[model samples]
Target: MKSGIFCLSLDTELMWGRPDLPIWRQRAATVRPNIQKLLKLFTKYNFPATWAIVGQLFLPGDPLWHGPDIIKAIRKTPRQEIGCHTFNHLDFGRCPIQEADEDLKKWLQATQKQEIKPGSFAFPFNHVGHLKLLAKHGFKAYRGPAGHWFAPLGKAGEIIDSLAQITPPAGKPKQANHGLFNFSESQFYVSAWGLRKYIPLSSRVGKAKKGIRRAIAEKRLFHLWFHPINLSDQTGPLLAGLEEIIKFAKQQPGLEINNMEEMTRQLN
Candidate 1:
C-alpha cells in the first residue's frame, strides 16, 4: 500500500459544495473564497494540484462563467493540471452510453483548446451507468468507485472513496451519503466538504493526518478530493482551515501531494 493520489474536481454547481443547497445565485458567489484561499496556500507550498475544471464554468463570452483570475491563478499555481467534467455538467448516468460519449467528447473538444482531453473524469454526480465507455472515449482513467459501484468489477482509475460525513442539515441530499461506497481495500471516496467534516471523521487533524500519513508510509495511495468551489465559498471553516491542512500535508514525510496528471503518470 502507498499514499494514493489526491484528485480535486473544481465544479461550479449547487450539488455538494453549498451544503445549504443554495440556488444558482448563491452557488456562484459561494465557491470564490474557498478557491482563492486554496490557490494562495497551494502556491505558497508549491503543491501541484489537478483542477477538474467544469467546462460550463468557462463558457465563451460569459462573464459570470469565465473566471479569468481563477484560470490565471491555476496557471500561476505550481504543478497544477487541468481536466474536464463536461460542457454543461451533463448527467451521464441518465443518458445512453453512446449519448454520454458524445457529450463527453464535446467536452473534450472544448477542453482540447487548452490541450486537455481529460485523462480522468469525476462523473457529474458520481452516478455511473457504463464505465467501459470511458476507456472507449480516450479517457485513460475514470475517477469513480473502486468496485461496489458496479458490484463484481472494480479496478484502477476507479478510485476508492470514504467520505464519512457527519453533521447533516435535515435530509440526505443525494450527495450526503458520505460513508465509504461499501468497498474494502484502499478504495474509498471522499468529497470536498469532507475537508471540513473530517472533524467528525477523526478525533483531531493529527490522528486523521496519521491515517493519511500511514497510507503513504505503506506506499498505498490515498486520494483526498473535493471541488474548488467547495473550498471557495464563504460558508464554514474552508478559508481558515485550508492553510492548516496544507501545512499539515507538507509536514508529513514521504507524503507528496500531486496534480491529477502526475497521479495518473505515477499510478496508471
Candidate 2:
C-alpha cells in the first residue's frame, strides 16, 4: 500500500520585525490565497492532503488570527488531514522545551472544536530535540526530514551511503534506505525546492513522475513535502506544476494520496 502524500505547510510569517510584519500579514493577501490555491489544485486533481497549520493562528487576541478560516479552507479539500507545525515555526531544537510543549498544548486546545485529532507532528526546520517529550505527550508519530530520519548524519545533502556507513547518534535508531518497509526514493530528504524563478514545469513534473513510476514498480512511498511560504512571491508556476503532477497521479490506479498520519499508521 504505497501512498503519495502532499503536505501543504501553512506557516504564518510572523517574523522578527513584528512592527513591519503586519504589512505582509494581510490575511487576504497572504495565507488566504495560497490556501485557496491549494484547495483548488487538490480538488482539481482529486488528491488528499495534510495541512500543518501554525498554532499561533488560534491565539485569541491576535486580530489577524486565521484559525476559523484555515479550518474552513481544509474542509474545501477531501481527505485533508490536520497537523501541527508549532505555535509558530520556531525551530524546536533551539526553542525552550517548555515553550515547545506549551505550543503543542495550545495547538491541541485550538483543535478542540474540530473533528480532527492530530496524531502526527512535523518539526519546524525539521529539527527535533525531544522525541521522548512528544511520545510522553501522546503524539503518535514525529515526521522529521527523511534526510536523516535516522539522525546524526551531518545535516541533509551530506553523503552517507547507507545505515552502515554512519554510526547512529549515541542512541538513535539506524535507518535502512534500501530496506523492506520503504524504498530509497521516499528516503530522499529534500535538499531544496523552489530554487529558480518560474522554473520549467517539466522539472517538477519529472520528479513526481519519477517518484510515481518508481512507486508503482517498486511498491515504494512517494513522499513530497514543502512549505506554502516557499511559493509566497512566485506561486504561479509552482501551482501549475503541482496541478499537472497531481492530475497525473490520480489517473494511476492504486496510486493513493494520503496524509502523513495515515501513512504512519499503515507503515507502523
Candidate 3:
C-alpha cells in the first residue's frame, strides 16, 4: 500500500499577507512570536512543514513588516522548506502577466540575497496564475486552489463546511503545465480570529482527523494550510488544537508527514 501523506504548509507572510487590511498591521507584533511558537511545536512533534514566506519579509528595512531574523530562524529549523509567496504578494490571477513576471523576478532576487533557493511556491490568496514564469524561475511545485466543488462559493462555503464539521477532500498531486507539480489543498484550517472565533476548536481538530483518516484509507495527500497570523489572537488554544491534530496524525500508521519540497521530489 502507498503511504498516506500529511502535508502542512504555512503561509508565513506577516504584514504582507493582508496589506489591504489595516487590522493585520495593528496585530503585527504577534506574528513573529506566533511563528516562533509554531516552530517549537513542529520541533516537539518532529514534523516537517513548508513555510511560504513573502519576499518583502526577507529584505532589511521595516521592523514591523520585514523579518530577516525570522527568515533565518525558519532556515535553521530542521526539515522545514522555505517556499516563495511572491514579492509584494501579487494576486497572480488578477494581475497582468507582465506585472506577475516582474513580481516573480523581484522575489527571485530577494530570496537569492538570503541564499535561499525555493523549489516550491504558494500563490498569494491562492489565486494561481503564471505557471510558465514559475517554471522559468526553477520552481518545482506550487500549492494550487482547493479542489472541492464548494471552493467557488468562497467564504460562505468555508463557513458551512466548518460548521458542519465535514471531512475535507484529499487527492494525489497532478503535473501542471511547465512540469510544475500542483498540490491541491485539502483545507484552510480555520483561524481563531474575527467571526471565525465562533468556530469551535473541536470542529477544526475533528475535521482534520477525519481528513487524515480519509487520506490514509485512500492513499491520498492531505494538505492543510493556514497563515501564522491566524493564531495571533487565540494563540494558546489554537496551537493546542493544532497539536492535537498533529499528534493524531503522527499516531496513525502509514501516514507520512512531508514538506512541500519533499513531496515535489517524490512526485517528480
Runs with alpha carbons beyond 4 Å of true place in candidate 3: none
Instruction: Tell me the TM-score of each prediction against the true structure.
Output: 0.68, 0.71, 0.96
Candidate 3, overall lDDT? Answer: 0.87
- Highest TM-score against the true fold, candidate: 3
By TM-score, the candidates rank as: 3, 2, 1
User: Candidate 1, overall lDDT?
Assistant: 0.50
lDDT of each residue in 1-268, candidate 3, tens digit only = 2788999999977788777788988677798888899889998988899999889888898877899998888888899999989888889989999998899889889988767885988998898898998998889999988667667887777777988889898878878689998888998888877678888889989899999999999998999999888887788999999999999998999898999899887776
TM-score of 1: 0.68
**Sliding window of 10 residues with minimal summed lDDT for model 1:** 167-176
Residues 1-268, candidate 2: write the lDDT tens digits. Answer: 4433333333343331133555445422455577788887777666776666667665444545545666666776787777766666657888788877887777777776675575666677667656666665556655555544445645332333221232211111122322112211132222223334333545555655666665566554565565565555556766776777677777877666666566656666
List candidate 1 stretches off by more than 4 Å: 1-9, 12-22, 61-69, 146-210, 232-236
| Residue 202 error, candidate 3, Å | 0.4
Q: With candidate 1 superimposed using the best TM-score fit, by how many Å does residue 221's alpha carbon deviate from the native?
A: 1.9
Q: How would you order the candidates by lDDT, starting with the best?
A: 3, 2, 1
Worst 10 residues of 2 by lDDT: 166-175
